[model samples]
Target: MTKFLLRWIASAASIYITAALFENVYITGFDAAMLAAVILGIANMIVKPIIVLFTLPINIVTLGLFTLVINGFVLKITAGLVSGFMINGLFTAILASVVLSIVHVVLSGILGVKKD
Candidate 1:
């Protein structure tokens, strides 16, 4: 539970970074960014597994690259759920997803999660 919260915060940090660094992404405020993170965490927790299972066949066929699409979907969903998060385009969402992946990896690395 605690670990999950930490990862969620890290994910939001990455989101905030993308908003700060990238022109296309827009977050209204830091609070909005944090809320977006929590929303994303919930979506990943409750929604992503179902999506992964539903897409399992293609995932295997694509060697798991479908996950990028899934991740972007999650971000898109997050945007709709929260008022402050506005992902301008598919490309921006994709870029945000990459930033998210990097942040998750780095934090997970520091926390000593074994990488696959």
Candidate 2:
């Protein structure tokens, strides 16, 4: 429970940092970042798997590199769901996703939050 909350906060911070790094990825405020984090988490949990499954052949062909595109799509879906979180284009989303992934990993490590 405590770890979950810590991880959630870390995720929010990661979102905020990622938004700060990308011009086209806009997060209105910390509140927006928090909301986007939640939506992103849900989207990754639900939508991402379905997308990965559907794109399995291409993913295989790309040696799993296509997962980055799927991550971008998930980020776009998250932006669409959150009111104050906006990603301008698929290209920006892809770039932002890469940054977000790095930020999340670093934050998770710092928070000692083990992936489940």
Candidate 3:
């Protein structure tokens, strides 16, 4: 469970960084950020896959670009679920999702967490 905790911490850091860099991505504080990260991760793992599966044809039609929209939807849902985590708008959520994805990837690499 050490790796899981490490990844969770990395995700929280990514959320914090994304909030810092984007005006529309608002994280109230460190505790909020951590909770948001967990909520986002759970949403991504559960809701995101179902959404992506349903939107697969559209995803293929859009040459995989719709995945970003799926990610944004998950982020928006996360914001709605978490009281202190707020995304100003859909567009901002999309941008923040993209940034978060990048940050997560970098953190995973740095932390030596293999992507499977």
Candidate 4:
């Protein structure tokens, strides 16, 4: 549970940084970013698994490139569900995914994945 929260915070930071670097993605404020992070966590928990299962063949075919799409979709969903957070377009979402992927990789390596 603690690890999950930490990862969500890291994800929120990554999203905030990515949006700062890119024009199309934006969160209204620091509190908005916090809200967006929790929304993103919830969306990922609910939607990501279904997407992965549905896209398993594509994931296999692309050798996991489709995971990026999944990440972007989750980000987009968070933006749509959260009023103060917005992702302007798919391209911005993809760029954000790139940012998030880097953050996720680094954090996962340092903190490790949850086995259970």
Per-candidate clashes come to 0, 0, 0, 0
Better model by lDDT: candidate 2 vs candidate 4: 2
Best by TM-score: 2
Q: How far is candidate 2 from the true structure (C-alpha RMSD, Å)?
A: 0.9
Model 2 off-target regions past 4 Å?
none
Expressed as tens digits, the lDDT of each residue in 1-116 for candidate 2 is 99889888999999999999998988899999988988899998899999999999999999999999999999999999899999999989998999998999999999899888
lDDT tens digits, residue span 12-100, model 4: 67667767878888887767777888888788788999999999999999999889888898899889988878888886797788887
When summed lDDT is taken over every stretch of 10 residues in candidate 1, the lowest stretch is 107-116
Question: Over the stretch 2-113, how does candidate 3's per-residue lDDT look in tens digits?
Answer: 8888888889989989999998888889899789988988898899999999999999999999999989989999999998899999989999999999998999889987
Question: For residues 4-105, could you state the per-residue lDDT of candidate 1 as single tens digits?
Answer: 666656667778877888787889887898899888889989999999999999999999999888888888889989998888887778778888778778
Best by lDDT: 2
Which residue runs does candidate 4 get wrong by more than 4 Å? 1-8, 104-116
Candidate 3 residue runs with Cα over 4 Å from true position: none
Give all TM-scores, in the order shown: 0.80, 0.96, 0.93, 0.79
Error of 4 at 22 (Å): 0.7
Q: What does the lDDT read for residue 3 in candidate 4?
A: 79
